[model samples]
Target: MEIIQTCDEMAMACRVAARPLGLVPTMGALHAGHLSLTTQARCDNAILAVSIFVNPTQFGASEDFSSYPRSMERDLALLEEQGADLVFAPPPEEVYPAGFDTWIEPGAVAEGQEGEVRPGHFRGVATVVAKLFTIVRPDRAYFGQKDGQQVAVIRRMARDLNLGVDVVTMPTVREPDGLALSSRNAYLKPHERQAAPVIYRALCAAEQLWRSGEQDAGALRSAALAVLRSELLVESVDYVRVVDAETMVGVDAIGEQAAMVAVAARVGGVRLIDNVVLV
Candidate 1:
């Protein structure tokens, strides 16, 4: 896999390829989830460009940007195995440069869940994704449902800007015990690892409640919060929202159209998020 760090070189290389492209943007500690996105992109597009940049602007002041996992050697191997045509592992400085000023505002969609916790997070995400889209000019892009809020924000940005790229949302990949596969999962200690699965469990509980003819959003959220509280390691609940998947607006009742029941919590030092469809 060819790894290029500079925007000029990367853009020139993409131009030289002169083929339809697909992109899978990531913050690099490669996992099965990431591999799935890469493989799907390869199957769907003429060429695949996998970007592994750990974006700092997305994180809040106290967040784990500096300590987030990074293993480019392994990341490239995984992408190559998944048939990615190119790997762009740009340095933060290379992407941001000096005196970079503009940002993409996802508006109200960026104000809840992940955004509420990390202000300017979606702006950073939107700006970086817009930059990547400009550089790669991919016909399609892949994102995991694990970051449901992010997918919503990116789709909104694409629509608002008329970027003309298909945004595909893939299912969330999970471990056998049901913890969502994430780069940050590495931070969990031995005991906290066991507690980590609670995020998914709580989501599952909400699903069960929904399936059993309970459609009230507030009640469903309460039930999920109860499940999370069952586990002592859950320090705090950031949000337990039942929102329209496309608009990210809270609904009073789920109805025939399903809504996303999402949550974020502090498990020791790690912040884990998980969601399920309430149908």
Candidate 2:
């Protein structure tokens, strides 16, 4: 696999590649969830590339940016095994430069949910992802539905800006016990890890209600929150929202269209997010 560290090098490499290139952008610290994207990229395109930069812009002041896992050697090994052709692991300076003033403001779809909590988080995400999209110039880009709102934001940005890259979203991959796979899962203490699956269980409970003809969005949110509240290790429930899948806006009732039940809570000191979509 070709390992690229600079924007010019990455752009040059991509320019010479075969048609229909696929890009999978990621922060370092590879997990099965991330590898899933690479797997699909390999299947869909003649040339596949992955980026592994832990974008500093995306994290809040008190967020775990400094402590976020970084294992470039291990990440490269995994990508190579996954059949990736290129790895663009650019340094922060190469991405942001000395005075990086421009930012992509992703408006409404980003205003609620994670955005409300993280503040400027999606701006950072949008900026870095737009940069990656430009640098890689792929025919399609892959993202996991694990970050559902993020998928929504990026899709919106692509459409609005005419970025021309097809945004393909794969399903969220989870652990055997149902905990959604995440890089932050590394921070979970043993006991917190044990309790973390509660988020999935709670989302499942809401899905069950939807399947059972429970149309009231408030009821679904309450049912999920009750499950989290009952968990002894759960520090707080950030949100348990039943939102329209496309717009990322909360719904009052389930209609013919799909809706998503998403939950974010602090289990131990680690914050984990998970969701299930109901049609």
Candidate 3:
């Protein structure tokens, strides 16, 4: 795999590379979940480009920006093994630069839940993603459904801004015990790692309620919240809701639409988000 580190080089690489390119954008520390996206992208398009930038703009003042995981040597090895054709692993200054001032104002889709807690988080996310879309110019971009709100925000950004890239999302990869794979999983202690699967179980509790003819959104929220609260390791519950999978807006009933039973909580002080789509 050719590792291009600068924007100009990446643009030039895109210029001569094959058509129908596929992009898998990531903040490196490649796990099974990330490899899953890369593997699928390789099969779907003629050229596969994976970006490994841990965007600093996405992290808030108190967030783990300085300490977010970085394993470039291993990440490159994994990408090469997964058959990735190109990788754009840029430095922070290369992406934001000294005078970088412009930002994307992600609208309603980013107004609640994770948005409420992590203010300006999606703005950083939207802006960096827009930069990637502009630089890579992929025919299709892949994201994991684990980031439900993120996918919704990016989809809206691409459509409203006419970015002209198909934002394809794949099912979230999970462990055999159901904990969603995440780079932040590295921060969890042994006990915290063991307790983290409760997030998925909470989503499943809400799913079970949906499957058992519980249509009231409040009740669904309550069901998931109950399971979450039962876990003593759960330090805090940020938000648990039955929201429209597309718009990230809260829903009153299941009806004919798909809803995301999403949860964000601090388990052993390691914040984790997970969801299950109830159709």
Model 1 C-alpha lDDT per residue in residues 51-133, reported as the tens digit of each score: 99999989889888888898988877777778878888888898898999988888888888888888899999999999999
**Cα lDDT tens digits for candidate 3, 1-279:** 899999999999997889899999999999999989999999999999999999988899999989999999999999999999999999999999999999999999999888999999999999999999999899999999999999999999999999999999999999999999999999999998888999998888888888889999999899889899999999999999789999999999998988898899999889999999997
Which regions in candidate 3 have their CA more than 4 angstroms from the true location?
none
Tens digits of per-residue lDDT, candidate 2, 1-279, equal: 999899999999999999899999999799999999999999999999999999999999999999999999999999889988999998899999998899999988898899999999999999999999999999999999889999999999999999999999999999999999999999999999999999999998888988898999999998898889889999998888888898898899999989999888999999998888897
lDDT of each: 0.89, 0.93, 0.94
| Model 3: ten consecutive residues of lowest lDDT | 201-210
What TM-scores do the predictions have?
0.97, 0.99, 0.99
CA RMSD of each candidate after superposition? 1.1, 0.7, 0.7
Best of the two (1, 3) by TM-score: 3
Please list all clashing residue pairs in model 1, or write none if there are none. none
